[model samples]
Target: MSVVAVVLTALMFVLLGPVAAHAGAGPRDTGSQPVDSYANAIRQSVWVDTGLDGDRDGKTDRVAADIIRPSEPAAAGRQVPVIMDASPYYSCCGRGNESQVKTYDQSGNPVGFPLYYDNYFVPRGYAVVLVDLAGTDRSDGCVDVGGASDITSAKAVIDWLNGRATAYTTRTGSTTAQAGWSNGSVGMIGKSWDGTVANGVAATGVEGLKTIVDISGISSWYDYYFAQGAALYDGGPDELASEVESSGAQSHCSAEEQALRDGAPRNGDWTSAWQDRDYYANASKVKASVFVAQGMQDLNVRTKNFGQWWNALAANGVQRKIWLSQTGHVDPFDYRRSDWVDTLHQWFDHYLMGVDNGVQSQPMADIERTPDHWSTDPVWPAPGTAATQVGLKASGTNGLGSLSAGAPPASGTERYTDNPAQDEDDWAAQADQATASKVSFTTGTLASDLRLSGGGTVTLTATPTTTSAHLSAVLVDLGPATIRNYEDGAEGITTLNTRSCWGDSTSGDSACYLDTAADTENVQQTVFSRGWADLGHYDPSLHGVSLTPGKPYTITIQLASTDHVVPAGHRLALIVAGTDNGLIVAPSTKPTISVDLSRSSADLPLVGGLPALAHALRGGSGHHHPTATTPAATPSRGPAAALPTSQAARLR
Candidate 1:
């Protein structure tokens, strides 16, 4: 052969030799591809048309997507699954541990990507796609704020990946683009707003969506901004929509912004607009298995969001896994660190790559007991737990009362005036027996550790002086202790200047992140869980019932779900008040409320026997063994037998 022919043959051997050797290799056989090698990789951006004119511009809106994948598999005629994260904050707020945003070159192609997903998964033989939701980043249209456009925009990308939708090289549809390397199986993962998009898309029952990992995500947009018809935040949907959209002339999307405001009215009631954004209502359409993680103490997204969504998924028989924590809005990376990476690696391996790693066989739920401490259980709330009602009785001349197993006092009532200015701390700081703005009820030091595994209900049979008033119920743990101050930061992580590396780094991305330490605070008492309801919205949401001048109403407030251990010597207290200044938009008029001691009680979910506790309380005994059957009620006077037989029967 001639020298030129020999040289061409050598070049062919160099390119085809490696591909021939690993022709039959699958993701399961090789685990993840080597991290350092990217000789066979593809990085590009595409615009997916969502088939919607969100801003009424007479043209369809397009979603912006930046993709990074192992080109070796494609070059060798192999198809790979995808791991996608659809986020609206990519341009404005960024994402992940260090809040890194996507950087583009002068030609408008992505040069720098945020977070560790691309760096970690791209080398693992999986394609990673980071998408900018429509109306944010480089995408077209207006921010609909979790409406039809918001959800469909992301779903279109999944369709395109599966070869069911159209995509283009430019927003104006200059040239066609296709996901030729994709195998049609996609797993979506994200935190907060990004995760919300994942949930919304999954609810659409998109064909190619195999699974989703939603972290600190909202299931209902209405719940995020309001609580039982009470506004929890300053701005409504309109303000938030305008805030998250790409920074530009406000007049461009003024009409769309006004529509969002009109949809979410100032009264904070559920409207048709909210119904379109409620993922919980449409969870039955989900075909994908779900992995959820949320902080039990997260006041931002709130625990109710996860609890309701989980319940809906369970009712619909959707496969699911959960991680419940005591920290506030946080990512698992900052909370569990190394373990998160390993578990996530396994999770993606199993769901996206079809690897049988026994992840599905493990416990369904993992709960954080305290900072850095965790326990795994087969199910949340531990399955066999029962609801036990603890009676509230008039204790002393002071307004404070007692929480006990026995019945409440007959014909006695405690009164309080609504105070909109008092926050949680202010309410807890006031002398329990002297506060007129709230009524406090406390149990004596516990003889044994009492564990509360689920949400609690505070039922109040009371009469309000006004037509409408907001009620706030709080469960407090009164004891000196050190606890994670989740209110301070995500997972209570205090960011330090020092950096720590967690994974392999690339030219466009770094695996190192700023070191973070748990933020712990010493305190005498902490609010375990809280609930709020506008008195007018007692019957159902959006439908308010006017109160008669002196008529009594039975209002049941469902507190935020939680898993906590009220340790030995710690007192469990329940506080009843009007308006949580820090959480709710209080009613304008201050109303006087009278709670009947004989009728009102707090229902708690306890793991132990309730009758035995009641028997012990009645007999004035300390730490008696619980009986399997219900204890017979003994005839007594005062508060011991003050609970009406009919009411007690209703409780049972």
Candidate 2:
């Protein structure tokens, strides 16, 4: 085994020791107080060396941290577990549904911390640490984005909490301090960028990290900025680095910023830099139980981040739970308020306090069916779900087609030219049978509600007129709909003129927050999911294989996972095009492409035996029904065969 692998394996054995015996039990009572009781908590700030000199200052860079803990525990000689949120946005962009930024006193001690974490957890017998990631806020170093420095800086704080590292009241102070009242157990929790740091730190095989709660976070920085060899936006790594770096003299970190850009080129290829940032690549090193909450429609971080990470964790036998929602890029607190707080309390109580709260025996997955409705299941993508391949066949002359159960006839093809100016909505809006920029396929009215419960795959054989092209596949719902207006409420909440209180308040912060109203939009149709691919980079992520012009090549694109119900009479549609104007950078050269109808199909994972019912609904025979003016085309593989209606009904 590789050196890193061997070390990680050894570390896993060390960390996993004895935990299985009391998997769902709480720690022994050491004068532990009730979770609801308030204690007079002390607030302070500290700086720890991360053992890195990104700015070439001849000494290791120091990271800034704001800490709050119950004074009673220290007075009683009791150590408490810590809850840490290390982020770059603590000072600038703020946090939570209200975007509350951290407030400081004249002496540099934190007086007001963003979000409800410190206010709620500190009084409940936990220490809350809000850290300024290296190079951002008051931390001294260059922002390395999601590189080694970023991960290591956060890890150092955990090291200090566990008495393995040194810290000080000031960056260059001679006096030193240690976390004397900490039990050496830490739980990291945050949303978005903060949660992303938690995932990265956990993947470092760090000791004393008991659990992590990642909400709508990215597991792979490469995937966040690129998709199938295409850059998601115009500027690459340097632009992003500059955006997140502290507001100050840019020349201080110019070299570091340039390094980021050089590491992540515009070609969308993975380098060692991206590999270092990918928590999924290092998932084997994670020893903490994970709880993830993400929106299926989160366009910012995207659903693939959570889905792929969850799958990797499962494969590695890591204990985990998830909350999948329909809202776009939203946090569980905004989507499901009361239940979220309660569940979180139980989760932390079990993991950090070792309390046997029966949290482990509960359902592992909670999925949203609508804005206000939810369903619980033992596992995500439910156990009995099966993948059903719905074939695409040419329909009318205007690029419109049909979703068929069987393959198309031997003689049919659809063609379209890449349009850089067209976005996903523009392509989806082409209901007319003759739009030249894209091709669309629609299924017949459903006989019953169809619940698609997992990730989807799109396979197609096509020949591009040019050597390269960008392909975008969209899975859409073809029916009138009213859905959460995630685009407008990018933060997932709108502050109303009213306010309400949830829990007890303190002098520096309040448990009360401005009331938020849900935003919804009505549309004729909605694009449920989409995936993208670049024809040239079909071989591997870092390597590009040049495509031969006019040569047929089969490409498979993995669609984002989702759990949505297509009501009866609603048709499932698939749109194939060369560009998603809003989500990706279009190819510079527009290429004409022809798709082989017989070889193109989409594999959808639906709940129960919906595949059998789909065949029956599309005319008992597994063939396209003949139109009034045209005869039914012959299936390339075989003649149309029929299944017993009784059997189909039974399966349904």
Candidate 3:
């Protein structure tokens, strides 16, 4: 037995006194199943020094780490790799489908670990470390939002596991604890904010981190809270910081929170505060292979988060894989439970355990074509995909226009007033009406199946009559299909009362969790992707600029990424408007904007090129049939209503 591991095992025995032995659950003598003695697992805690006095308490802050590992004394000489999930939500909100929180005994030892990570992986010879970010839980620090404080709080633990940082038995104790049982191989996994930390840490080029599974995670804080120069919500950084800040932060974190507001002004210009938290800028330094998953319709974290980061990583030649779903901001375990568990297990075994699993040989991307319908793409965005510009030609009547290939031959102008009362639904349902809140452009019917992959951009040439204006563009599929009702549930999945258990169980913690089902809706129109930009920030620098009342300036609004196939007979439409109701912050003034039709266009990323569109329009029925033909139930809203109040991570 290795000396260090032997001593650790002796200490565990001394502390635990005695334990009842049980075999890994299953029929005996049938097969070589993985063994995990759940009841005997070593559950403990350590305070990792972050080397930062974020609270200004004159002492370095410490992040609380709850650890669970196999207690097999027979394998005393063997060191284990780690699976870590670090998050600020550990103490405030919750994790997984059930919103499970951490529980501890009187002596501060962790009694219950949230999620199935510990219950499943620890029994298979992996150590699970759940970390409470420095600002929350039992840690001592102030929340810096997505700043250095958040990244370092997680990174310090990875450093400690690799013998590069220090750990203590207690928050204020001098007694040191060593990670002698670690082999220094780590794989980070999480959803939302937790997954985001994995991305940030991997970007640090951290040595021990071999892989990260980032699910519906963010790459940039500014991009999430704001787009280009437009604020996505009425609230900003200060409000988000307060949501995750520890109670102790009342004394010291106020300054940090205030600094966040000062650094990133509400005007939506990019600043150093956002730059400091951007992991995509440092993606070239990432050594860890990444597995990313996001909803094509995820409005909260937004598909742009994955699109931008994925492109940068691919450009840098970083190894990667992906999953593009048709749902919203929900975890895969809640939807694709069996497949997720199996694939994740193989991923960890291959990366962390050096197992010769063929995880790398599998398909590059798993795409949900529709609810419960999946297909694997050898390369995401589909091969041979390219950006095709579709011209917006004003019809000169009925508040409608034609979306044709290439630029318009003649110049024309269309105008609309900024209407906060109207949304995408109103624009779609009242296209021919003279409401003036939006301009609708549509393609002819009977086109061939047009498959789109990746993000698109909307360019408009117009002059606003007000000092400030906001532009919103949406790409809607005007066809009938039964899709996941993301607007009905918070994350598009309804958590049912029924339960199913995976892995081992114990008195304090169990692998059992509530089942979930996709909330489906049959609709004639669905908004696949939308984007916004502040018209005032029209300059290339994206800094605020004064708008001359009648001077025209060209601006581009970036649409979120998505993959969808618009079948024959179903027309595609591009709707442009100002002040997108419940979404973005409305314009300072209700601007009556003139859109130059000759210069305005929507660039779409499509597979099979121009020939495909021509073929689709040449006359043929759609390749598929619809589940229902009714109009949409809720058109203007997004898929976020069903999320339980307590489980809202709000930001990635």
- Alpha-carbon local distance difference test for all models: 0.76, 0.75, 0.80
If both were scored by lDDT, which would come out higher, candidate 1 or candidate 3? Answer: 3
Each model's TM-score, in the order given?
Answer: 0.88, 0.87, 0.91
lDDT at 461, model 3: 92
lDDT of 3 by residue, 85-169 (tens): 9988776778876778899888878999999988788877789999988778888897777778888988999999999999998
What is the descending lDDT order?
3, 1, 2
Q: Mind giving the per-residue lDDT tens digits that candidate 1 earns over 532-635?
A: 88777767656566677578888788887787777777767788999877678778678999988788888887766486345334423222112222223222
Candidates' RMSD to native: 9.4, 11.7, 6.1
Model 1 residue runs over 4 Å out of place are 1-30, 33-40, 406-411, 429-432, 489-491, 545-549, 609-652
Q: Give candidate 2 regions above 4 Å deviation.
A: 1-39, 247-249, 396-398, 406-411, 545-547, 609-652
Candidate 3 global CA lDDT score? 0.80
Cα lDDT tens digits for candidate 2, 1-652: 9999999998976554323322333343222233333335788889998999887768789998899887766675778889998887776666776767788889877788777777667666788898888888888888787787778778999999999998999878967878998998999988877788889998987999999999988899888877878776666656655665676515588888888888888887778888888998789999999999987767677777887898888889888998987776666777677798778877887888887667877899998766667889898777667787777877646466777664545348998888777766665555434567788777777666777777888888889988778898988776787777665534334557876665556777777777665666676667778888887766555455667889987888878877777777676778899977767778867899899887788888777755654643553222122332322222221000111112111011
Clashes of each: 1, 8, 11
Q: Which candidate wins on TM-score?
A: 3
Residue 348: error of model 3 in Å? 1.0
